[model samples]
Target: MANELTEYQQNLVSLVQSHELGDIIKPLIKEIHLFDSYISGTSHLKDRSVLEKIAVGDMLSLQREDNKFDSNAILILNEDGKKLGYVPEKDNIIFARLLDAGKLLKAKISSITQKGSFIQVGVGIYLVDL
Candidate 1:
């Protein structure tokens, strides 16, 4: 099979290749949510004080849990390896399977929000070039 780049990937490549010296280019991969933390049951138990300190671009770690209700459950962690929450059920299966299949997926803190009783933490998953 021939390899192909998605439209989005092609655009990013063009943007990068056309850059001149001193050009200020933003990250090629913008922040995207692989999961929503607000809907997670353990999200509330996280230390808001700590979560608030998490900033964009901060690297995150994912841990696979086989015993969780969702067999594909993936736990998200902070830099210090503290459990922040989990990858929401909606997107957990695919992500977990990818990890299990030996894919090198990197995650980062994309955005964090606190509104009323909801604490939303969005993670950005980066697909590394093989």
Candidate 2:
């Protein structure tokens, strides 16, 4: 059989691909309970990192490398989806900074602090002063 999809299937794919949040659902963000998301035309499923386990409804952003594959400097937001801190991967990321553009984070709040509020997410102690 040919690898094909009907127009309806295509439209469904588009809807899922675009991840447009509707009144009853949300976009496919990392916080979704399921981390089995897959990229089109590839077997690259979203990595089931410890980060992907964040509670549902939590807002998250990713940090990319050259606006592509995983890199560093990725940040995570609070439950309210506010910029709380960066991922850092495993080390300090000095460049390739892009928010709401190329950043894609996969972490969660490991701990909390005051001042403003920080998190032990993606990489680790990303503190953000209020």
Candidate 3:
């Protein structure tokens, strides 16, 4: 069969393709959970107290941070826009690519655990659509 798209479908694709990724409209669909992992470099946060206010199910923001150290760095922030940590280095490459493509991604607090002096904040990354 010949590959084809309806007029409306083709128009939608063209509309989306015309704008930058960040300018594209969010789809009217439920968010998709992509993966779960503990935030890295929590100990290095400027204000570790922000971790205490986090709770399960709280929505967080994912920002792509370009640095000389780790080019794939994705900064995780709290609802108040406070810095939490990062989506571990090994797992950040794909997330970076998705964010770079203008995909809206977020992280939800999944679990929080304390191990001695270390507080591990677990989060579930998601593809969010409005």
Candidate 4:
């Protein structure tokens, strides 16, 4: 592939509002110093040519809360702002890992009678199984 997005990158692109690409990618593309890093292509080499450049790109119009997890994994909450599930390191989003591995892949609703719902998260993948 001349340029391919990783599963996580793909999920990110998927999450992006196609109507507004700049608004979506500018925020979560991952930043380092002033230059923001995006998965230009799926090639893992750290080269600038194939890499998309944004030394000073537009920041997120909406401020996204920065939560740093030392483990590099993070739990994504549901719509109600409740813990739903986690995304592993390297941003691997596989159905097998989320479903077959018996991982802490799914978060349960705290109360049976609650109107809230569970969110499914695996890296960039957000599957609404519940």
Top-scoring candidate (TM-score): 3
Model 3's TM-score against the true structure: 0.77
lDDT per prediction?
A: 0.61, 0.33, 0.81, 0.30
Q: What does the lDDT read for residue 37 in candidate 4?
A: 18
TM-score of every prediction relative to native: 0.61, 0.27, 0.77, 0.21
> TM-score of predicted model 4?
0.21
Q: Candidate 4, residues 1-130: lDDT per residue as tens digits?
A: 9544322212333345354774745565432222111221123233323212212221211101224642234443443443323333344334323322222232222221212332211122323211
**lDDT assessment of candidate 2:** 0.33
User: What's the lDDT for candidate 1?
Assistant: 0.61
How do the residues 17-88 of candidate 3 rate in per-residue lDDT, one tens digit apiece? 456753546353457999988799999988888988989999998888877899999999998999999999
Off by over 4 Å in 4: 1-71, 92-130
Worst-scoring 10-residue span by lDDT in model 3: 5-14
Tell me the lDDT of candidate 4: 0.30
Q: RMSD (Cα, Å) of candidate 1?
A: 8.6
Q: Encode model 1's per-residue lDDT on 1-130: one tens digit a residue.
A: 4543222223333345366621444444343444433325444664656676678778876667766478778777777887777777887777766566554445776676776767676667654322
Per-residue error (Å), model 4, residue 29:
17
